[model samples]
Target: MSRNELVRICRSNSIESYLQDSKDVQYCSRDKPLIQFFKLNTNAAIDGDTDGLGGIIRDSSGKEFAAFSVKLPAEAIHVLEMKAILLGARLAAEKGLTYTLLESDSLTAVNVISEVWTCPWKAIPVLADIRDALFCLNNWKLSHVWREANTAADFLSKPTCCIKRVDIPVVDLPIDLLDIIVADSNGTIYPRL
Candidate 1:
């Protein structure tokens, strides 16, 4: 089925309906390509006067592809988290990724984007932009992860970290986050409260 048809079906019925209907479609064939996976996190300083947003994208084999971080003007933590998700989606779109799975450590942010929870007034615009970005993709998923499992993004999102506003290709992982990245790639689980 064409991507537009799939999107139309998803909008008319539901994701489950579209999946069930498209089981025999060519795009959903056995040789389907691997989906891109990305982890996103955001942090606000002690005074909530400055926020940092970060995200890391990886291929199916767990190899990092791209990473990005940006400092934003003062905002609520939830707003910052939502902004991080928006940035991730925009970056994926810019890179022309057709399929992606975005992970965020903030359950609230994930829920808001998935429409499982209502978005705050301050975050509606950002959430709308994220939705638009997702709609442009052939396939995408958004889910929540434990902060422990998302340490690389968490570290990048630290207010004190010296990350540029532009997206960075992950050719050489930052020395500071090498250990955490290795642990994540090795499937080392960390306890989360």
Candidate 2:
């Protein structure tokens, strides 16, 4: 098929439709004991030099257990996304969780980490670290999640006035993110452009 035809076909069908057509792919497993759903978001700074990376980890029951936000020296969104995944994996390993399901809003980052696509040169080291961390787990899976489903992570990623350059551990879900977390647990659908 031509490139234009391929693009048109993809745009016409929803992701759910494509997944339903394929039998080999599975997004989640109900039997896993410690599923960690992680979402990463990156924001470019005003100077366009640094990027804010944010990630949140939730358990199988959709409760926000831990989260982190950091500022990277570089500004590439893909790189930041990879770093976020690395951080999430490291956190899971530290917590001694054997089974993890890491999800990200950036499909490109997920594809690279899952070996569905080639890893970019700039993100090689970050991907390596992520891979090493994944080895510590008995089983781990990475998948793409819609941005709307990842609102808490997206909100955590943006630069805040009080947050310094250091990574912050989120002990409690922010007031602003409470509603989004509830919606996500309820499986509320938000259309993505």
Candidate 3:
């Protein structure tokens, strides 16, 4: 098929439809996979104090793709939020994914990410970077989810463990929070390679 046809098919297909079809393909490549696999399902949440931003990224298959929590001074919550969004976007781009839908528990943050209104001064540059990153992907969206539904991101955002990249089995509680459990159980916390 022609490239135009491929683009049309991608543009017309939804994430669920694409994932259903991916199973039949032998080896998926980046060429059209981002259009297919990149669901852009994101959720970000901040506490009342706004000291940190927590979020998640899932591909089309509903898999736990990426999770992050970034900490900031209470005074710099807005700026840090933009940075967090940008960081998420950058990670998505590096992974050759597109068509992301960013979600935030904070309506204010959602608006800023979506450009529904002006971002605060300290946030403008980071917001600009997020816009540029999404533009490169050719598709992105932002929405808000309730806090309860955003637990995955919230867990990731907690101030506990050091940051590293690897596939981790889902845990009921975040590792940082689990430290308390470990201490009580008198078990050592081991790092996994």
lDDT of 1 by residue, 1-193 (tens): 4656555544532354445555453322101126444433333232366677877776665666677777777788888888888878887888887778777778888899889999999999989888898887677877776675677788778766675543455555567776666656655533232
With a 3 Å backbone cut-off (N, CA, C), the pairs that clash in candidate 3 are: 40-100, 40-101
Question: lDDT of all the models against the reference?
Answer: 0.67, 0.62, 0.52
lDDT of 2: 0.62
The candidate with the higher lDDT, 2 or 3, is 2
In model 1, the runs with Cα more than 4 Å from the true position are 1-48, 165-169
The digit string of per-residue lDDT tens for model 3 on 20-46 reads 455442211111114355433233334
Per-residue lDDT over 1-193 for candidate 2, one digit per residue giving the tens place of the 0 to 100 score = 4434433444433455554455553232112124443332222222255566666566666666666776667557888888777877787777776767777778999999889999999989988898898898787778777665567667667666224322234445567766666656555444343
Best by lDDT: 1
TM-score of each: 0.74, 0.70, 0.58
Position 13, candidate 2: lDDT: 33
Give me the candidate number with maximum TM-score: 1
